[model samples]
Target: MKNKLPLYLLLFFLIIVNAFFLYNYLGAGDQGGPKDQIRPGDFLVKELGLDATQQAAFRTLGREHHRKMRGLLDDIKELKDALFKGLSDDPSHQVNVDSIVHLIGEKEAAKDLEVFRHFKKVQALCNAKQKEKFAKIIEDGLRVGGRDQGPRGARPEGERGPRSKGFEDNRPPRPNGPNANRPPPAARE
Candidate 1:
């Protein structure tokens, strides 16, 4: 009976801890649904304040857009696989690899165009006030890191300050020292 008492106490403690965890975990959303489950079109209904009719249209548009995007994305994945597989074997397959990369780029451009069209449809459904808010949302989404970082993030390759080049090493090369230009260490060893 004493042995059983300890086991019963341990089980009771575990049950209490599990109930506490489940309560907090489920309560985190406050939206009364599973934490991991996402309702795909809920953002339009909730964030954009879409009416029932608009929500239905948005959902339909979203579904069709996603279906088209899925095909493009899958083709991109397949082309990427073929390109990498070429890399693992023949150096002579460079032409084929380049062709695969071009196809992937085309598919990506199509997917991006589809997204732009989808958002344009969404914007059309917005009211004057909602359209203002929607414009802000799109603007914020497009900005790099949510704000223009200016030259710090936007400088072109050769236009970056001289010290920013990969070979700069931030130190003057030793004059005729052991590390001096001896074919850049590639031919030494």
Candidate 2:
């Protein structure tokens, strides 16, 4: 046990250091997702035909927008916590449920409004062509991630559940493509 103490201490220090770096990276930096957001930046350059100086200005505006978005999300989280704390102790009791729900809805709306406001602020910094490109990208994202949709062909697969005929066969084929050496499928007599 004594000999293992140093090893454990070393591991703990490493964890602390890693967590410190992670907090710095994730806390305020890169608020706008990742390289995909960079793709949006690229689209603005290509589709809008922005000059280098304009692109530089847009990057600054994008960073500010990301910072504002982070602030709004933090505010929303605080509001949610306040509402949660205001609730009654009894979970099943309906007391304050309606009020809490309304508060949460308002908080969400505020967050959404902040997002829209930031969008417009950034858009205002861009020329007409840049705004057009941004709108097209936003529209594409809205169409790709529809709420009612799970994934392509989801309904057909859901339709083939255990309740359907041939359900057993639909079980995933063994990793080695039918489990060649496994006992043959039970005689389908």
Candidate 3:
């Protein structure tokens, strides 16, 4: 009877602990933040605190900007495909690579200018308070997306250091001394 009593108490304690853990696990589990069905325009409308009139303007601007940007983006993708296709073929086929790169740059620049103009239109709809909030929101977005940074591998203005001539992939530094290009003794032997 004594042994049975101890076993029953142990079982009860285990059950209580298990229940506590199970309750906590279920309670602390993530509830997905927002509905998955929210569209970007919906997010912008809500986050930007747009009124009915502003929302209409925003939707119009977004639609036009998306259409223009989509065409430019498609052009850029086509140019990239051409560039890579040439690269994959004989090196001689890459003679037009420079032109393709230039076209891509032009398209990208146009896309950027279009986005800037679209945002300006959006900003025009904002009141003073909303404008201030909008600026902060834009700043936060640039910071988050790292769009404010210079091009990759480009030094910031006023900073002058020797630019790397080419990519170095885990290679030993090139020796500049008299023995730089001499064959090793083992190779000579």
Candidate 4:
């Protein structure tokens, strides 16, 4: 009976542990999970306060844009694959790398145009106040570091980030006084 008591207690403890694991794994998702993540389109719709008709139109536009972008991206991938495949082919085989690269660039340009057209259509659905807000949103998105810094997330105007080793200015420091541009004495000799 003493040995049985330990076995029963062990079984009970195991059951409690399993229950806690199951509760955390299955229950945490209901509170905050992937399902709660805000998609870009949903963010736009919510931000713009799109009405039922506007939301429907926006969704349709989004679907069409996604379909077109997918096709363009697939085409770009194929071109890139061909470009890399050329590297493995016989040396004598002709592979016009430039043409393949140009095609990829064209496809990318088409994607940009498609996105521009999609946004324009979306703008057509907005009221005046919403349009202003939309413009501000687009401007914010286009800004470097998204409204905080300069191009490529560079430090603001006067401030500089730490310089990486080996990339430091290789040129000799400029002479600060009267002989700044004068050649060195050895060079003059």
The candidate scoring highest on TM-score is 4
Q: Candidate 1, after superposition: displacement of residue 45 in Å?
A: 2.2
Q: Give one clash count per candidate, in the order shown.
A: 0, 0, 0, 0
Writing each residue's lDDT as its tens digit, candidate 1 over 96-134 gives: 877888898899999889989988988898899889888
Q: What is the per-residue lDDT of model 2 for residues 1-189, given as tens digits with 9 covering 90 to 100?
A: 999999999999999999998888888586746655556666666776777877787788778877877876777677678667767557764556666667668768877887687667657766787788878877777778785466553354335545666675667643332544354567333
lDDT of 4 by residue, 39-133 (tens): 88999999999999999999999999999999998999999999998987776655487788889999999989998998999999999999999
73 Cα displacement, candidate 4 (Å): 0.6
Q: Which candidate, 1 or 2, would have the higher lDDT against the true structure?
A: 1
Q: Number of the top candidate by lDDT?
A: 4
Per-residue alpha-carbon lDDT of candidate 3 for residues 1-189, written as tens digits (9 for 90 to 100): 987998999999999999998877787565635647788678768887999998888888889989999999999999999888786676775558878898999999999999899889888988998888889888998898988786664554334345643434444645343455555566565
- Lowest lDDT sum, 10 consecutive residues, model 2, at 173-182
Task: Give the higher-TM-score candidate: 2 or 3.
Answer: 3
Best to worst by lDDT, what's the order? 4, 3, 1, 2
Task: Kindly give the stretch of ten consecutive residues in candidate 3 with the minimal lDDT sum.
Answer: 156-165
Off by over 4 Å in 1: 1-40, 144-147, 151-189
lDDT of each: 0.78, 0.70, 0.80, 0.83
Assess every candidate by TM-score: 0.59, 0.48, 0.57, 0.63
Compare candidates 2 and 4 on TM-score and give the better one. 4
